[model samples]
Target: MSETVPNTTAPGRRSGGRVHRLALAGTLATVLGVSLVNGVTPAGAAEAPLSQSGKATASSSERGDLSAAAAIDGKENTRWSSAFSDPQWLQVDLGASKAIKKIVLKWENAYATAFTIQTSSGGGQWKTIHTTTAGKGGVQTLNVSATGRYVRLNTTRRSSQYGVSLWEFEVYGTGSGTATPRPSATPTTTPTTIPTKPAPTTATPPASGTNLPKGPVPPGAVRVAEFLAECPYTHRLPDDPIVMPGLSGGSHMHSFFGNTSTNADSDIKSLLKGGTTCSPKADLSSYWVPTLYSDDKPVEPTGTTFYYLGEGIKDELMAQTRPLPLGLRIVAGNAKATGVNDPTSSSRWSCLHAGEVGSSKNFVNCPAGKMLESYLDFPHCWNGKDLDSPDHKSHMSYPVNGACPASHPVIVPKLRQVLRYPVSGDPARFRLSSGPGYTMHADFFNAWPEAEMERRVRDCIRPIVKCGAGGTP
Candidate 1:
């Protein structure tokens, strides 16, 4: 493994399903479906300080109270503090697209020396609006021209020995909602013309990916209600298409499987056009994990199995289970674990042929000839709206009382990753790119074609019948 730290970072994590949503489109002053800033004339367009009404999130926080929300709460005394690490961020999601005018940063002692300001229109893509390599601490106001629904500060380097901290991060912008009479006026301060709306995200559903032969179920079919795929280890890269999207070389080393072209900029459209290394061939979904190393040498998994099963919920709910949505991104396990017994950690390791050794949160010393194995389970509950969330999680939840929670009503097949490495024995020799074995984590980006995914759900997962890669039981 090339890096020995958590590869991904999610800034402003406090905004991801933890804060109340802003009611921008509802009850706002709109003359003809176009939201107008109150007390502002057409000639002198006023920009709403949108950050106050929006949500803020971050990758990691130094403490629970020192959250991303503090930066956008319009309170200068309060601040957001990140874990002491490089490549952290803080982002705000304006309720709607807006014409970005200016950004103000009220810095504490810990300030970013190198950073980039990025914008996005609720899509998984981002545009760089501003970047700074030489940063002066204290309060700094930046004038920039950009339009986006989200504004993020990607901090690459910190001036202080501690992590980045922001007392107040403000964004001034006008709503992107259509305006009545289509005012051609610009900002009262230097006006920069921008489009009414950003282009719609590219979301063409991909064709079914799989060519497994369809045949009648044998009398002794597995009876597991599982749809499985074998995607062996393919490559190692420092790219995370989910948490670190659009920022190349921003993550720790990762072992990739299934998709051949997954990168920092990969989205559903890009994966659909790439080749797959999976057994079924058609499932181009990308799967990755922090690379494992033993004795300072990388260890690759010889056996990789992804199981989509209807095992967590009752059969009745399984019947209502929907196919994994396209472009869905999920993360499992805690990458920031401090040790094997960290409460946030959720990883399991065992030996393939040494059952007597038992499973553990950290690496286990398997008997001779036994291979080390890792398993991670992803949640089955779906929120049904957003394909991705600010924190990479929070859009999905684990079943409550054997059923999906009301907040996340959509039931989906539970996904579990089982990986078996060829080497085992001394536990002291094993370590993941993230950390110890307890810090093992995994990431999944869904690019499976709708038709193929639905078929697997209908014929196998929903019906509680074990099916092969071709969706036949």
Candidate 2:
């Protein structure tokens, strides 16, 4: 992936306090009703900032903090709630009334589509403001110059093809007055490239303080290759046929009983658990990585990081619907153990591994009389053993039988692995205003309580910074 330089340059300051608000409206009946009924004001009209007592909270800068009341006025079951589920909502509270220039909305993955942004001076009044279509990966930027204390975001549709999630939202003001541009290196000409092996030993820390994000080589961060190898498996997709990169339509079809789609990039982002993906390539590596690499080496130094491209099998989609006419891909590279008696398989095998299922009732072709091998599995299977079985006590305990039954199939979690870097070029400038580590518009995590956010910063972010600086961890 390409290295991104945080935007050190600030915007030229504009005068006159303009009101603006960003509201997240999920399917919450009460919140959506309140916003829709309020009727938003027209864009560009002078508006007032919201009160702290209102449903939304305020920030001097339009930098979005998901936890802020203003950011999630109408949404329920949000990422912040203990009952967090997919399809949440958020609102933006401009600390005070200020003329707004442009608004940037970022999605965790393409969880939302056909979303609308409305503006309101008082929480009760609203206006139909802006709308957008969604993509499976990357950021979507929308431009609007409106004044209001509150801005509301409502989703007409959440991509059922995928679930819900989000990373950040940012708003910029027109530079007529207070904001001043700092001299930042221009946006790089090349995109960042992904590296398969560990980074070379001689790379130096980025000249800018590692505190600032300026491309892939942060001050002390370990190379992406190292992080990928050591990271834990967070989740996985079904064994579906790969969505071909160029194909314009259709969600993952589960025709192949065991197959699944890795098309959704959000799958990779959740590996950070509460944080955003280490970088944007969490998914979309399928297409981005293939296009940028030649024999596994990158084509660019700073930016050419590949994203997970859609998947493809070089055959009709229906071919994967049944048992393999021929031996299928046996991915074994990430395995951790060995031997018929060993619970963990050797990681060297780079394809899907298979063995006999105990019974024919579970397989369409294999009769009860013969041993069978099918990708599908019996119920409650985890690492080949029935998780509900009496002998299957827990993840920490091994089954009395050394190996799991083939019918009880399990996939090693591969979704979170950074399969490839998607971009190649000089790091792009990420504009930022505040937040402990995020001063620019680079990939960042959603903050937790003060202590949790600080812990992650020290344990994760700081070390990555140090690695980029050519220092020992």
Candidate 3:
């Protein structure tokens, strides 16, 4: 159960000698303050991405942070997750008009079942270049000839429960004139050209409870029955007790919180004896996530990861929400998610501030002065027979319609992890040690004293009351 080395292969990146040379030439020209043949690819040179290298803008975003820029960032692990709705559109400006040769769409699981490829030259009106009513999700390469400064994908129908998502939306061709590439204007709100989508559905991974109202106990208040453990950053390591147990440095880098002495070999016994950074002194639980990176340097979280209970299930289930069992390890979110719509993925990324930016299942372009955040809800239903399963997650399950699955009938406190990273500006500068934001995941090793854990669930959570670090109102 402990010595396996997890696979960490990243998607193949596109590269070519001619493309590199072209990109380098472009860079050198920019440094010298000169312009290349507008955007024209030289004779026999392969065409390059001509989207003006800017943050993308879409009709709408799922939440702040998941900006439209992700789709054009050229990283397969990152994607643009839109709000669930029909007639959503994503567009990019090429600085100035260009000769479009090919447009490639790399879709996640939640893909556009029907869409139109639109281009605009100098006018405000969009001109359709291609249309499809039976589009399949995955990688689609379209050959086309068009001259425009803007390209857009207007999705009209979705094939999955989630909104349309794309890992990459690439426009390949040559520049038309001496126009220099510019950063696309990143917007917080949806473009005014289209109607905003409705609120996200339950199918979307739940967002953070940062703005949750705190009520002493007024009637009709938001029934957010929860107790919290705010564990600040403790350390960084290349070990995972749950995934690569006993194999120190066998996994990717991780920023750990709570128990300070955790390592690949750590267990409940060792964690209990270790010191902690949690606000509540009794909590020695170990929590960790893949370390975030900015410009190739490891960045530790400036904010703590709050461990909350009684978050996802119905209020009535609070009474049955038992404290996490000692030594019980659980993982929330999928570190191996290939794209935004990976069914096993449960992580969501958003801007830290309220409505400051859109959210996504991939990396988000959080506005400057704001941090990026992630949310994940751990499975709350447990199989009484086993403390842990062979898969490490099969013993636990998320409730269905406020009821625990029969296969795992015992209800437990739904532990929701909210983690924040100190990063802003271009999301293209960010990447997790695992891959991207969508692959973000956290692991928990419960080591709290049985009595203290029990009291919090019994008094704070069960009664549908919010409790502070002390487990009291």
Candidate 4:
């Protein structure tokens, strides 16, 4: 289910403006006695990268090239340098309202000596969450308690005479919470409506007699599972270790789920060594897709229900299905072709309230107050020999006429990703970070523990049984 928060702003300020600084400053008076040390939380545990997926802005830019968005662009070399002056600030619109927990500021020598970390709803009135007078130049990791759609670094004093330049501004938290619904909002045009249908309460088991033998069955069987994720947001990196290595930014923008640390300079080895932000806390692998941009701004999903399924073999054949190997990397959907005309496109668009799924090559037109949803199915057939191929895609293939080809004969659990964006109709305003909708692509990294993955695949997936992190559906 989704939870809504009010978007009401204080009097005399527009949504998403920095005009309420005086009001926030007055409110800071009450918390002046609060020690800065009390706001620091232990940064040992890993958390999600919140700032990477949000829209960034600043009070004033030093130049046109160095804009405010650079601070959250996930590039340490690129920075948002403000005009040389006090009372400058940099802020990010998290796309949707979320429960924020921490903020990490990577400075570029020209840092702020005195600043307050503030949050806001509708970017109007702000609330101070953390404040510091003595600022360092390297990095400031502050744990804060605040919830809002916007987070800002309000600098009152600069450490240097140059300006307040930030190499990176990182926000971390469980991206949970929903935006208040706009009145008279329709699903086909408006870009901010939440999904109305709740996910299925119980598992929808596979058809009877579909289960194959106890051991590995024929090469053609299919398997399926469904899971839920809240507030899946965008980050700059694709976490597929084989496709992208060494923490470099992905070729395109990406919407990330599962593992929260996908944006960090990482690889398969680094991912296996790290923890996850998933509910089970056992799924260390990260999942990402091209970021969906509407009206040149990022739009985040409040919650997502994913359908993981395969096609090809019957129930008996499913028994032979293998678990996704550790470090397995798969890329699905074309990142260059428009989603509607690309023959290789696996995405099918639809609307939740419309009660009908659109063609694979067409964008769905939903009525008002609906959501634009996309279903992307990945190849289920995998080669038994290799986890990854040189081409990064040759190891997997789709089933042809209910049969696996000789090249990719091993059947594995297929992933049917159901991504629900806040945007409705109006395809013209929608674009992926890579380009237009046709350039949409997704990446998967196998971070599951070896033994656990094997057990689940053997006990549940192979039997065509629905399952989650723990066990049977």
Which residue window of length 10 is worst by lDDT in model 3? Answer: 1-10
Q: Give candidate 4's error at residue 143 in angstroms.
A: 64
Error of 2 at 434 (Å): 43
Write the residue-wise lDDT of candidate 2 on 1-473 in tens digits: 00110011111111011111222331132233432223443444422122211223222111111123212222211221101223344555443444565554534433466667777766478876687665442345565778765566665565544333333344444322221111111111111121122212111211222242222323212211111111112223222112222232332221110112233332223322333222322221221111122233322112111111001111111111111101111111111222323322211100011111111111122222222111110111133222122211121111112222344232111111121122212222111011110110111111123343232224323222211111122
* Residue lDDT tens for model 1, 330-446: 887878877766765767786663434556789999877778877777777888776766666677787765577788788777787878798877899988888889888889999
Q: Whose TM-score is higher: candidate 3's or candidate 4's?
A: 3
Clashes of each: 13, 123, 13, 19
- Predictions in order: lDDT: 0.68, 0.25, 0.65, 0.57
Weakest 10 consecutive residues, lDDT, candidate 2? Answer: 347-356
Which one wins on lDDT?
A: 1
Among all windows of 10 consecutive residues in model 1, the one with the lowest summed lDDT is: 1-10
Better of 1 and 2 by TM-score: 1
Give the distance in Å from residue 240's predicted Cα in candidate 2 to where it truly belongs. Answer: 50
